[model samples]
Target chain A: MSETVLYDYWRSSASYRVRIALNLIGESYRSVPVDLLARAHRAPEHLGRNPQGLVPVLDIDGERFTQSLAIIEYLAETRPESGLLPGVAVGRQRVRALSHAIAMDIHPVCNLGVVAHVTAVAENGEAARRAWMQKFIGEGLAAFERMLDHPATGAFCHGEAPTMADICLVPQVYNARRWEVDLSACPRIVAIEARCAAIDAFARAHPDRSK
Target chain B: MSETVLYDYWRSSASYRVRIALNLIGESYRSVPVDLLARAHRAPEHLGRNPQGLVPVLDIDGERFTQSLAIIEYLAETRPESGLLPGVAVGRQRVRALSHAIAMDIHPVCNLGVVAHVTAVAENGEAARRAWMQKFIGEGLAAFERMLDHPATGAFCHGEAPTMADICLVPQVYNARRWEVDLSACPRIVAIEARCAAIDAFARAHPDRSK
Candidate 1:
């Protein structure tokens, strides 16, 4: 098998999301940690590979790619049997929509860089940043629960097996817990996270284990 | 052909993206105006169709979907000849990453709701919001310019033909121009947008025309 390499940071929900995907694909790769706090992502080498300055850029068969969802979609396409995305158009739409709720709506709004900017502008302190994260995280997940109410949602965000939606959901849930966002209203999301937790792919990809 | 309906807010970059895609596909859809100012997106009907409370919910042949990129991907898959995304895996990844640079990084951060939240906390008024948008938009476009510098970039975002990346790029450029963000640094993106502007597909999807 050809070697795959992942540029990662331990706690980034985006990076964590990609790790889960790699694990699910059963692809073993060397993980080169990008120390985000150390401002390593801003370095020239990293910028050359990914102008977005985001972590979880993957190199598979010498082809480099960035964006967690994009990388995962690439995997799903090249390695179709991974089931990263469901097969049918409607099913794929549902999974992608669910993934965006957290990835685009929730995660990006409260990204560490964004939050830092918010703090600098507002100067409202850590409590304010936490509150900001909590509010959006709560609302985003509540909406996610509504999306999951569909009959298609099973043990995962899509069906019986984990898809890209589940891969994204677990990490956002991880962020929610880290920021102490209350998940009382998102029973469906919590249940899916529980199911994902039992899977070795998800279990071994935990941020704690990534360390 | 199935009748397709797009629930849209004219000025929204996301809605604009779908409009361009629909135009590119040569598919006509009824556009239902969802007044973001009136908070119509929070209405029960809209929420039921799109739990995320965002615009550009597409209904075609009774199948409903959300997220502009996902909907575009579906259209690209179902309408293979439209060339919304490229045929090759590497090509698709490049297009998606470019789309996400604006969709996930710049757009979400400056969304109306997010900006409103910024005003509420920062209390710095419109100037602050515009500055905030400028900071991210400028940096994002600068990054996008670097992404465009690749050999893949052509008359549009990818090759000579317009793909999903151009569909996304046009609207982001629209937003950037509207927000008065300087495009001087992003020569490549500006050139692409100018080329896209001349195309009837993009012109018809203009927010002004949507009105």
Candidate 2:
């Protein structure tokens, strides 16, 4: 057995965050793919491991940790040298604010649950669903664009280094693009996503790239 | 003028999260209330502070930090003695994950935007709003109940000490109760909210009690 095993679904943004963090930290781990589309996350064994029935549970050294940002921070704190967070307290907060901007503000509203809700009640089927997605994904990406335009934003969401913010941002941008939201409006976000995609750590963690 | 000023609305759950953290850390600051109902968050000044136009922007030592969880974690880190996060790496991750369970998973879907969306589209009006609120709130609180019922839960969401998780939870529970969501199913969450409310920090920072 590997020292770490990640209970993850290939398309899950939460799981993608952990996968990128692990690669950045250079930690070797086994991937246990939990098929979310098939309701694998709600299975009895997975529920026992995580009562929340969420994917991206990181089994680290026999203990399980859930939540992508938390898992990433744990790796950063334990490894220290991987430098996912800046050394200074203020800088760390900035990084975290950017990360939460996507995780808390953007992703939650556009998740499978919200989409399903829109589809259930919306009048025109595909058009209404697409409108709902566009409104949220567009507004969220616009806000994220403003965040990236801040002087603190460099080659990455934070400074030149890749942090938890970048991990969350890339998956979100990918998802937004998948929904056919225009990226031309948010050049900063587009640039950052491109920068992140070029890296092996982020590239290797792409949903299609993962098993 | 205080070095830090918090842009908050008294009744906003997001702002309430930050207020509890500031009170817990015993930080002296100024409060700049942004009226959510009046659409003050959309104003240029507020939007400048947080492009997302959300409340609970912490203008700390001249730097502005947006997002409730981000601001709370910032305060916890800067004021280590507040004991908002655990000392060990794994413990910290668990605390953060529990906290994010509410912040990212629960709050966003039930907040103003989604509510407005439901109100705009749902033919059932008030009933639809309530249903939307209850569905997201139920899922979130049920997941939170499982986390709280874990062996790690003590008087608060985490250990005996109130951490970031409690800071996020109490406000959400308060909002849920405001909407008249049934709490009978979430004994653990209700119990933890009671434990947290008894403390002066949480009590004083309540929406009705704030300036």
Candidate 3:
């Protein structure tokens, strides 16, 4: 079989999600860092890998895949036993919904490019950027916490397994801490984060470890 | 079967995407408009449906579902003949990558609440809002157009069929036209939008028609 390659940035929430998924499935792969800080993602070579010029593009089974969640979905589908997602439609629906709440509702708003532009146009750039991150990350995580108040949510985001929802939540929580977003009201999220932190797959994929 | 109720805002891109999917599946659904302008989504009634307080919370098959894409996935999975997502992993990957390019990267960055906050913090609020929409939407679609330059793309986003990618594209194009984002360079996207516009499902789901 051909080798798997992951184009990623160590700290990107999207990239981190993929890293954890790969680890969960015990898929050993090469990590090619596309440094966002250096604008490496926008370069032509990187753009060739993904027109969207995003991180965490995976090349496996002789095909390249973009979008962290999509790539994760691809992996989950190919290796259902890995259980990145649930087997049944109802379980899948819940997992995907919880995942999107973070990946879509939270991560994108606090995306580096979007926040950079907002701060650039504001009077106090750095402070505006910090405020932007804290507000969105804090609010997004809090909503995610409320989302966890379901019978379906057990030790992880769904059932007792660490599905895609848990993979997504860990990175957002990481970002929340990075930006000092208050987690006082997000007890469920904090507990899930703590559980995920104990898992080897998640710990190996942490930004600190990867860096 | 239980009646399907869609808690939606007529103008929300996310809501509009679900509307298109329901129309495509020929599913009859009751539209309960959650007025974002009046902050109806933030009310307790809506929150009870979806803690995220987002529109397009679907009550279908006696279960409540949040997140437009996840609901669409459930619809697709339960009705595989509908072909909202492709059957194969590779096809699903491409379709999902295309979908996320718009749904995750573009739509969320231009979310109403995020824009409202960004604009409020800027000096010239209205102008900043316009520029923000144009910049993100314009760049996002341009990249999407580039993504379309692949063998998988056909009359629709993936193959000749309208999958989740097209479901996502239609609403984003609606927003682009609403915000008057320049579309000259996005010929593939423009052409796809035109094709999707010709379909009955897409036409009926149009915000103008729905409103």
RMSD of 3: 0.8
Pick by lDDT: 1 or 2, better one: 1
Ranking, DockQ, top scorer first: 3, 2, 1
**Residue B46 lDDT in candidate 3:** 90
lDDT of 3 by residue, A76-186 (tens): 999989989998999999999999999999899999999989988898889999999998998888888888889988998998989999999999989888899889998
Native contacts conserved, per model: 0.71, 0.81, 0.87
Best by lDDT: 3
Best by DockQ: 3
List lDDT for all candidates, in order: 0.89, 0.86, 0.92
Candidate 3 residue-wise lDDT, B1-211, digit = tens: 8999989988999999999999999999999999999999999999988999998899889999999999998999999999999999999999888899988999999999999998888988999999999999999999999999999889999989799999999999989999999999988888888999999999999999877
Q: Between candidates 2 and 3, which one is better according to TM-score?
A: 3
Question: Which 10 consecutive positions of candidate 1 chain A have the poorest summed lDDT?
Answer: A119-128
- What digit string (tens of lDDT, one per residue) describes model 1 on residues A1-211? 5678889999988889889998999999899999999999999999987887789889896788998888889999988999999999889988888888888888889998989988877856676798899988988898889889899988888889999999999999999999898998888899999999999999988999987
Clashing pairs in 1: none
Tens digits of lDDT, candidate 2, A95-201: 88888888988888888877788677666657777887788888888988887877888888888989888988999988888889988889988888999999999
Worst 10 residues of 2 chain A by lDDT: A118-127
